[model samples]
Target: HMTVISAREELVAFYERRGYRRTGVLTPFPYDDERFGLPQRPGLAFELLIKPLV
Candidate 1:
């Protein structure tokens, strides 16, 4: 299983082309949490991606 940000459409597409699929799981960006850093913009979120190696 893998996860990626939906913000990066190109990256998501690249992974999808390589056999990855969206898991429909979305995680909101940590706006309040400073662990990652302050978001430059609002409404930022991450989308979950998955792939099976079997």
Candidate 2:
């Protein structure tokens, strides 16, 4: 159960301020393969932020 957010890095800090913790997981996105998606770009990677309910 999770939601993925993708966009310009300018919003990185914005999310962090809201209590989203930066995750250690990152992956190089395959720009040419349809396995990922239709749109592709250079230096594109996935960043994860998680918040857990206690």
Candidate 3:
């Protein structure tokens, strides 16, 4: 299991090319948390991706 920023299409495509698929799960970006960095725009989220090793 892995998660990547949904906003990063290139990164998602990279993983997809390597056999990863979206799990349709999303996690909102932590805009309220300074540790995660402040959002300069809205609608940021993480998309869950998964691949079976079998």
Candidate 4:
């Protein structure tokens, strides 16, 4: 499983078309942590995506 930024719907769709599906799980962006740089906008989150092998 991997995560993509919630705001990037186009990327999500691109993965989905290749067999990846949404996990319906959302993770909050590390706003307090600057190791990942700063967000361009507010309310940024990550949506989990997975490709089941089983």
Clash pairs (backbone) in predicted model 3: none
Q: Estimate TM-scores for all models.
A: 0.79, 0.57, 0.88, 0.89
Across 1-54, the per-residue lDDT of candidate 1 in tens digits comes to 677767889999999999899988999887888887877888888888888787
For model 2, what is the error of residue 19's alpha carbon versus the real structure, in angstroms, after optimal superposition? 0.8
Residue 5's C-alpha lDDT in candidate 1? Answer: 68
Superposed model 1: Cα runs more than 4 Å off: none
Q: Candidate 4 at 38: error in angstroms?
A: 1.1
lDDT, candidate 3, 1-54, per-residue tens: 899999999999999999999988999998889998878889999999999898
**Evaluation by TM-score, superior candidate among 2 and 3:** 3
lDDT of 2 by residue, 4-52 (tens): 4345556766776777777757766668788777764467766677876
Q: For model 2, what is the alpha-carbon lDDT of residue 19? A: 71
- Candidate 1 residue pairs that clash: none
lDDT score for residue 27 of model 2: 61
Q: Rate the local accuracy (lDDT) of all candidates.
A: 0.86, 0.63, 0.93, 0.93
Segments of candidate 2 deviating more than 4 angstroms: 1-7, 33-41
What TM-score does model 1 achieve against the real structure?
Answer: 0.79
Maximum-TM-score candidate: 4
Candidate 4 C-alpha lDDT tens digits along 1-54: 899997999999999999999988999999999897988999999999999997
